[model samples]
Target: MSLEVKNLSLKIGAKKLLSDINFKLETNEVVAILGPNGAGKSTLFKVLSGEHRHYEGRVILEGKDLKSWKASDVAKLLGVLPQSSALAFPFSVSEVINLGRLPHSTGRVLDHQIITEAMSKADVSHLAGALYPSLSGGEKQRVQLARVLTQIWQKSDLGERYLLLDEPTSALDLPHQHQTLSLARDLAKEGAGVLAILHDLNLAAQYADRIILLSEGLCVAQGDVKTVLTPQQIESLYGIKVTVMSHPEHHYPLVIAS
Candidate 1:
């Protein structure tokens, strides 16, 4: 199964945030959305996650329009980690993560087990009892990731599910950045579709199966890493000179500013 966007477009007053955006996210693949600032990446995520629905085209999941799904059904099929989160009550990290399990009716033992596994995968297990609002920015980001991970932890019995992440590594350090993306790769390998908004091209090259590069609210290129992330495309998109070479380790294209 796949999530298909057909000629999708969004506008806010006089500004067009997205224009004729179309792509298919298949199961078990990580698709990274790359672009400079103001490229409409966040707006696209808002459209997909049901926050902004006044778009021009169709977003279909499992052959049905996404807007037609019930709220609980949408929850079952999609997990979203926004760029930032806020907590008002000073909830502990564990409590915040447990909120992801609310849609399911599992027993306490099973819920605890899933929460534990999610925390471990996010590398936030050590912060279990810590109050979420007191944690550092990077720690909070990891905890939020754990929460979303818990939301779509299990595969649906009907069809494939999806995870939408918006700049999930923005506040993370280098090691945690790799760790978070690695967890996303693992989720994709388990038959979940992943769409991540990322600024770091090298990380996208290493982990994403496909790349969608947007500029001025348009998709300029979309394909495998090597095909879409050419030096010419990179330079044109960012208006900067760059050297593109094979990575010394994995042989994927390594983009370095020159």
Candidate 2:
């Protein structure tokens, strides 16, 4: 029901990418990772998704070590959406979304139902018959999101699932940006752990239940939005002077350039 990372560290050749990172992502919460360029946010994600295993600590999922779980089992439990995905072959958006059903044993009727629901959730249903390669960057991103969502679609069967999103809203428009994060929040509300890597501080503050800020491969601060989005901390992290205030609508901490 929780992802526990303890004393995690990673190195590539002679350079250290992450050092002594620690955090727990529990079900029913959205945690956002924030940092400047080269702050090791992506590296941390690689470790969590089991793509980088040469680290120096433990990643426990549902009371079991991540290394102990089989790759197929992990796939059923965690869904990942990378920053960019490419499709060399011409595949319809619906076809691409159907690929997520590969892991499940559902019948054709059930699969279609799940695919339709996922596309609807991602706001990509209109792009169903469109060729994936012909779509815009934002459109493709949404389709990929639908695929990931479909991968973990049978929420009731997959106990304590997790969604790892790497800048999922980077190519999305204003409304879709909010929509994507809102969907992630909804997933968290459904008792799943959601972890996202975000560049926009305001968006992170608005959607994340907690924030973890990194600098030069080390964790500098981690806590609720109010505690982590302080002006002094943000200024120190991103090297920019900024004003922090309560959002006019939601009253969450809002950051603006000074």
Candidate 3:
């Protein structure tokens, strides 16, 4: 029903990178991880994605230990889009996106259909024939998103799908930034749990169902947008004074820095 991290802590060499962190990402909601630099957001993400697996504590995926799940089986349920992708291959955009279908035995016809749909959803359909390395940063970001989207395009027998997006909108334009998160929201509505690492408080407020704030490898706060984005929390974490106000046309909090 959810991805749960219990008492999660990670240490590299003698220095601790994460400490006793706990959070759950439930189905059908978008969650944003907000924090100052070096707060272990990316480290938490890497742990969840199985990149740094030597940490203490447990990551429970759907009532089972995450480490016990086979890599291929896990791929069917979780799609991860990191802060950046480094691929210098000459493959075309569509080819890069098609690589997402590798984990599935879905037939060629069905895989092509899914790839096309993902490209459309990620707004990279027009770049289907373009060389992957030739695209701009934002364009490459969308293309990488399309690739991950195709990976978990359908909810397998695994029950619920999950998206672990590390700064998904980092390279996007303002409109495309909204567009990207909107697409994540749509996916969540379809029963996927979305967890993204975001730096923009307003963007997280506008789209996330909840926000988890971390500072210095620990969670500072975690709750609904309005409750967690208070002026006090902003100042304490980022060392900046800000006023939190309700958006004039929307229901979420808007943090205005002074």
- Best-to-worst order by TM-score is 3, 1, 2
| TM value for model 2 | 0.97
For each candidate in the order shown, give its overall lDDT on alpha carbons: 0.93, 0.93, 0.95
Colliding pairs, model 3: none
lDDT of 3: 0.95
Go through the candidates in order and give the C-alpha RMSD of each one to the true structure. Answer: 0.8, 1.0, 0.7
Pairwise lDDT winner, candidates 2 and 3: 3
Q: 78-99, model 2: which lDDT tens digit per residue?
A: 9999999989799999999999
Candidate 3 residue-wise lDDT, 136-208, digit = tens = 9999999999999999999999768999999998899998999899999999999999999999999999999
With candidate 2 superimposed using the best TM-score fit, by how many Å does residue 159's alpha carbon deviate from the native?
A: 3.1
What is the TM-score of candidate 1? 0.98
Candidate 3 vs. true structure, TM-score: 0.99
Q: CA lDDT of 176 in candidate 3?
A: 90
TM-score of each: 0.98, 0.97, 0.99
The superposed Cα distance between candidate 3 and the true structure at residue 58, in angstroms, equals 0.4
Off by over 4 Å in 3: none
